[model samples]
Target: MSGRIDLGLLVAALTAALALSPAAAAPQAGVMDARAQIAAAPSATITNGLITATVLLPEGDKAFYRGTRFDRSGVVSALAYKDRQFYGPWFDRISGEVRDFAYDGDDIVAGPNTAMVGPADEFDFDTPPGWAEAAPGGVFVKIGVGVLRRPDDAKYSPFRTYDLVEPGRRTVKIGKDAVTFTHTLAEPTTGYGYVYAKTLRLPKGQPRLLIAHSLRNTGTKPIVTTVYNHNFLTFGGAALGEGLSITTPFQITSGRPPSAEAAAIRGRSIAYLKTLRDKDRVSSSIEGFGTTAADNSATVHDDGLRAGVTFHGDHPLSKMQLWSIRSVVAVEPFITLVVPPGQEAHWTYAYDYAAA
Candidate 1:
């Protein structure tokens, strides 16, 4: 009689045990599963031969950016240029338990309250209409996300995901080189509504991507807010450390500054110093810009990859900020939108990519 145990059975048991371990638990640390989640997500790809961008479409049952934070439509999940990838997942995985985000070793993990990628935009985040007046169960209007039910009497916060009351109507038009999303939302309870259309286009022969937006007030209420794009930029998953530089036309000043050891602010640039490990962070509320559209421009470079992107907008800069963790760096630029009933406002942004 042979005394050797079954080799295949032993291997399978060992694998199963590892899978059941706490450190290997998924939807948390075992976040490689995000690959499957992204694959199953519905999206569209647009390219101009120089740059290729894939946007996650909005769906009631399986939307890509399900969080209540950013505008869901035109969510760019992936972008590649010159064989270098940008705007990929900065987190290991997305979870419902995470209030906002938590540092996990080399990766940042996000919760349903704030899980998104690429240049995601948001409108009037600090003051969603009807939030204060709405009862605990009543609903308030969030322009891009839809109607959300008020959870409690607590002050409004972007760190928590409110229950969805309605998503209104979403229409999508996709082309080979461009894609557009139009959201028509009318919340009678808050007396606020609008027709918001956002278009992402890749110029035919240029290494540039453009985002044009038009917001038309369709309801009786006036829509006064500030809309900003969270330019979540990265280069091939490079750490947000040395060799990274962000430049703006105007000199840079900040009300809230980042760690001097992590980042340094020169005359017109935010310079990264040493590498970010563990729970290190860099963030600031950038100020000092005049009322000119030309001032609303920034150029970012990663010297290691010899690649970079420049972001500019047609509207004047109302506010700006810089933020980063270990895996991603974001330059947030804001513009004011004031549309009265039956009126509309328009703005545009351009991103030019370069690699040498």
Candidate 2:
């Protein structure tokens, strides 16, 4: 027998040795470990190899829009990405109190002296015929969507509650790359008979999410209202104060500018003046938007975390507002819908995240 093995035999032996080596087994072992860890994690949470998130179901009794009696039933909680949170603490504010308004039979007598709600069309249709002129005092009833109006404009209607029926939720995975959460709500009564649906998706291996919405008027009356997402952001569990800023692509004309001690606008961005103390707040409405949704987009950045988030929509933004207090920063983007009976309208929004 030859002292050395033949070349073909030697090659075969080397190949067999490599196949059994630790390096060759490491990849599969690592994968199995990750899978085991994920399987052990809590249910109500999602992870896509890159980011992890928790799903927040409606609290049933918590009111989304302060003062409104309607319960919140939808995807209404904080979104965590890149080790940072992107929502305000739930139940952080007091319930919005109903304002006094006098009613004389079917007509309002007095009380809501100023326009405290808006988007113009909702103020016209959602509110009673003569809310502003109603007698100086009367009973209070929650009736329309709550929105802040310009202080100088008494032409709009006062804040009222919109009865948001509890939303039905369905969650599913799309292939191996994404997960989708759908929330559907329909007006239970003949009043407002508007059917609303929203689908939120998180794609695997990406730093972005998508939200699609549809509204249909199922009643005999036309449904004219404005819908907006109040993105209340709390970065790294920090309050809204110094080191936080917001930027837009166009010039901003606020309905209410920030106070001198809170923040200021620099070029196309709003920079915090200082770390806000408790009760300190900054709020404003951003004007200067075109008819297209592409023109409406904004970014909220936190210098302390070196992280930021961008929000954009697929439909025209009828209005935009910014509000922040010591605890939360909210960027509200409004869309106007004029769906006739049996008609429907659709829109979508995208959120992108980045970190340095």
Candidate 3:
């Protein structure tokens, strides 16, 4: 492959599952009653009692996700551990049809704007600095989203939602288990800016959840980019093809392999042979990992709720891949963000949970 892998790891190889299948335990059985039935936005909830999480605060039209394609600063959601529930809400609403997701009738919409859900993190995801030579009233730069407006180019679709012009300086604290998000921008007429920060901890007793990041290169060009963590692993809402699976130490070879009836990479694991119906998918391009960071940690199992979670990274992996559709299963991992202007770059990810 050429990309993917990065979800969060370390729970002694957690594996002891089952329990949580009410559409994935209905947002941990009442996360403010499913955020008041999805859409009141402004969220924050962290529990150290045993891994309980939720973070989504950008509130504009109740920003659950306003689509610009990820990195809406720490926008996590329903991530239970013991009671079993890992990541939730995998598209079923929010559409405009710009580049990615779309369904309409039965729900599931994520296009033109509304690119959402957990582990959401992206930057310069395929052309974001002027989106294909900006023209049409020019302007571009999407480091945690801000300063966009390249309306009409026909190409440059991170699920199109452009036309913000400026959406920087955002902040959110909320602690008790941890939650911090920051964003800043300058954009000297397209020099690219940043200050980005993201945090989401829960380490009290330790079921695990730690995702820290930093980026500082404050404007004036020189922020070569690449930031990944789309690991939408949805054990909650579990149902993405036969009991789910994905375990990797490094041996996934994929020259675009995906769809051997669904999934099956073998060697280091990537099973799941059937269950993703209707618009089904299982993308690939996850080559053999090497070059450090413990060959890149990864683990995800479900054997029908016999839960598992492990995805760690302290930097090194520059790309890895795996995508699963039918309610999520992303193994995305890519990290490389050279800073220059002012310089500063950091990466961290950890997640470990299990169930019995």
**Higher-TM-score candidate among 1 and 3?**
1
| lDDT (10s digit) by residue, model 1, range 257-291 | 77888888899889989887677788888888889
TM-score of each: 0.89, 0.63, 0.32
For model 3, the run of ten residues with the poorest summed lDDT:
21-30
**Candidate number of the best TM-score:** 1
Q: Compared with the true structure, what per-residue lDDT tens digits does model 3 show for residues 186-221?
A: 878767777887878888789999988888887777
Q: Ten residues in a row with the worst lDDT in model 2?
A: 17-26
Candidates 1 and 2 compared: the better one by lDDT is 1
Off by over 4 Å in 3: 1-69, 72-78, 92-103, 119-137, 145-149, 152-159, 162-192, 195-217, 220-356
The residue pairs found clashing in candidate 1 are none
Q: lDDT (CA) for every model shown? A: 0.78, 0.49, 0.70
Model 1, position 14: C-alpha lDDT score: 30
Task: Give a tens-digit lDDT track for model 2, residues 107-189.
Answer: 22212121111111122333432233333332112223211212332333334332222233323322222223333323333
Question: How many clashing residue pairs appear in each of the predictions shown?
Answer: 0, 10, 23
Q: What's the distance in Å from true for residue 253, model 3?
A: 55
Best by lDDT: 1
Residue 46 error, candidate 1, Å: 1.0
